[model samples]
Target chain A: MSDSPIDDLIQTMGLMWSADGGPRIAGQILGYLLIEGEPRTLAQMCEALQISKGSASTNARLLEAKGVVRRVHPVGSRQDGFLAVPNPSHSLLKSVAKRLRVQADEISDISARFPDERADAQRRIADFAEFYRQSADFMDEWTARIGPARGETAQES
Target chain B: MSDSPIDDLIQTMGLMWSADGGPRIAGQILGYLLIEGEPRTLAQMCEALQISKGSASTNARLLEAKGVVRRVHPVGSRQDGFLAVPNPSHSLLKSVAKRLRVQADEISDISARFPDERADAQRRIADFAEFYRQSADFMDEWTARIGPARGETAQES
Candidate 1:
């Protein structure tokens, strides 16, 4: 805690990047947005993180693309507020669904490609992917029952 | 989904890389080891993965370091038994503990570094890390009660 908001933000970013999701600058941005529970302007974000204007732009855009964060526009104002998805757990549910669908497709393609040659291995892979979908669904239901991770403020959770 | 054992191994590696644990190459190795079930020689692993001999050695060493895979010596043989740890869910308990310990210490340092000036930001960062530890503890306990994942024979469901 360097007694500055900027230092704290940087520290949070470092911690998030060190986690499982990703070890990248964009991850840092998402972590900050997700945990802060506040909407911040682009300039404010850049200033707090002591990053260049261009770098902030790129990182913010990346976060938005991930669907974990979004750009919000205030009433009658040009300044954009970059806010994290209001419901972190629910968003994760959606992500799980999308990722599982894609993986299932991949597994299907793999099974088709190999035919009978590596049949056992291919079957196992597809089965595992299906299991993954089950696991994700399990998490979604669990979260819905428990709560939307601490800061999400989601109603259902 | 290719029936090719080799392709499955590669795809398995990619899946582990994207899983709940950090993106670990050692985990990739572990997945392949699990699929083979029977222990493999280091030479076989190197050939299948298409990596250099040195890469296989180093990566195997890394997997061994993580406690997710083991190097066992078969009876009456000098060569080691390259096998996965068998039950990964319990292993996750230990890994989560280690990761959370590091996170706790890092967040403590951040708290110390921050003065009273940026109290809100400092609080946000601290809580974010605190929640991660709480989540880890919860998941670990749940998994322990639920038994193992990744094809382990469940002791109890």
Candidate 2:
């Protein structure tokens, strides 16, 4: 309930996370975990984000499955808590790259159904997808070079 | 049509064009116009961009309306054709900024309806939208400084 910049930051992130890229809801949970700063209980997330508890739980679990955020139980609490890995910008980039790859693949498959008529379009799709793949790889390298924020220290993979 | 790299380039371009950060058929038309090296007839675009004649006509008009692309008649022919300006990367930055602006305005209007309890969440949305305005401006400046592609010159507005 405190006025924190992180609250704004969280919502901004949710806009991106909730971005369907076509039509999607994944963005909300990513945004919440992103600014929570530490692992938080489901109740905290639902209250803070003003989303239904079921929605919070579902999206939180989705983030964990994608390896963008993780589930970590606090020492004395029975309730499950979650934390996003430090340097989530890298996570964000990788997620985008992976999804783009899927899109590229789907486009390619669609092109395939059209026979030789689509050969050219198929090639273009594959080539551009390759561009995105390289772009994503380049981002991974670039972010790693920039390293973590001062004092936080980078966590080794 | 011949196997012009430009055609593959256009096909790839079409595939790569995004509206609001997601791909749109309008983008491909813009890409084709950007690189086809000359204004293309409605016939040429329909063939190259792989859209219907009506779709090409409709989208090209929309692009013209947006000031991103233009309609032109060939030197002496009666054919209707179009040309795309070589915009800088910052053009994308600016367009994205514009979309964020619209979202921000929507937040302001939407907040007026929330009586009390939901006021904070609406405020969060309004703040979130404001942040993108600053971000979009920053991106536009940064992109302008970066300049255009190596060999391709961009005409500054």
| TM-scores, chain B, all models | 0.74, 0.67
Top TM-score: which candidate number? 1
- For residues A58-154, write the lDDT of model 1, one tens digit per residue: 8787666555577777898788888766544445444655665566565555555655766665565555556545545555665567564433432
Model 1 bad stretches (over 4 Å): A1-9, A18-23, A27-38, A65-70, A84-134, A148-157, B1-9, B15-28, B93-101, B148-157
lDDT of 1 by residue, B1-157 (tens): 3446456655655674656544455546665775665778788877766667776678777666655666777999877768766555455455656676567567656665666775765666565566556546655665566566554422221
Candidate 2 ranges beyond 4 A from true positions: A1-23, A30-72, A77-80, A83-157, B1-7, B18-24, B65-67, B104-130, B143-157
After the best TM-score superposition of candidate 2, give how far the Cα of residue A126 lies from its true spot, in angstroms: 18
Measured against the true structure, the TM-scores of the candidates, in listed sequence, are 0.71, 0.53
| TM-score of chain B taken alone, candidate 2 | 0.67
Candidate 2 recovers a fraction of native contacts equal to 0.02
In candidate 2 chain A, what residue range of length 10 has the lowest lDDT sum? A148-157
